[model samples]
Target: MLVGYARVSTQEQETHAQTDALRNAGVGFIFSEKRSGGSMAKRPALEEMLTKIGAGDTVVVYKLDRIARSLKDLLIIIERIEAAGAEFRSLTELIDTRSPAGRMFFQIVGAFAEFERELIRERTRVGMAAAMRRGVKMGRPTAMSEAEEAEAMRLWFTGDYTKIALARRYGTHISSIKRAIKRYRERHQPSLLDAA
Candidate 1:
């Protein structure tokens, strides 16, 4: 028996192409899902497929990355398959772990995939650091505008509106309302450094 698994990172992505490839490879049963390959815990379909595989069964995937993003994860999954008396095969990479050379090539491909991911992470860290050095803000923008914060602060001080009311009025959470007031206080209050 050939058991296939296909995956996409998000709901916006489709696994049609991968499933088609698996079917073309003579896989009669396939488990497909839209979920990140970043973690094995998040992929229930992959887990189900692994459990369904038995002796003399081959686990097939359209690509290696579709099954796992890191070499450690890839090796762990392969070990599980081997332990179940099953083999592994990848269509795009032409890797079939039924032979010594095939297993070696599979590991080599997994190593490259892990290396590429590390490179991407390193580049992203460098880019974010450079942007920060240039005084660019790196996180999500404030939910409330400066004018809105000022208005919230003024209303809060007036004692006419409660925190919940301010949140409802601003269409933001109570936490945002509290933060706005906190920012207002920080801006207006004289600090110890200023007193010195």
Candidate 2:
């Protein structure tokens, strides 16, 4: 059996090209998903396909990066495939783990992928640090201003309005209102452990 796996990193992306290539390669069954390959635990389709594969089966992917985000992940996936008595194949890389040369080449490519990821991480960290030095704030804008949050907390304490009602009044989520109240309490009152 030739089982294909196709993945795209984000919901905005589509796996059509990968599926088409896998179909053209004569793959009978193809599992596809629009999810980040960064975490193997999160990709249910890939996990299902792996669990279904048996001896004499080949697990195929359009590209190596589509299947794994790092070398360790790639090796772990390959190990699982081989342990199931199944072969691994990458369409674009021309890698087939059935041969010794192919396995070596795949590991080499996986290593480079890991290195590239590390480089990207390092660059992002450096860029963010530089931005911070220039007084740039990261992350999403706050849902409410401090004064709004304070008023919300006050209204919450009065018990006249439910957290949901407070959220509606403030145009924020209930969770945001809860967080504001929690923050107010934390600042105004010390924890039991602190008193102890």
Question: Which clashing pairs does model 1 show?
Answer: none
Question: What Cα-based lDDT does every candidate model obtain?
Answer: 0.92, 0.91
> TM-scores across all candidates?
0.77, 0.84
Per-residue lDDT of model 2, residues 101-136, tens digit only: 999999998898789889999999999999999999
- In angstroms, how far off is 194's CA in candidate 1? 16
For model 1, the stretches where C-alpha displacement exceeds 4 angstroms are 150-196
Poorest 10 consecutive residues by lDDT, candidate 2: 177-186
lDDT tens readout by residue for model 1, 1-196: 9999999999556889999989998999999999988889989999998887899999999999989999999999999999999999999999999999999999999999889999999999999999999999988787888888887888899999999999999999998887788878888999899999
Alpha-carbon RMSD, candidate 1: 4.4
* Candidate 2, lDDT over the whole model: 0.91
Lowest lDDT block of 10, candidate 1: 6-15
lDDT of 2 at 70: 88
TM-score of predicted model 1?
Answer: 0.77
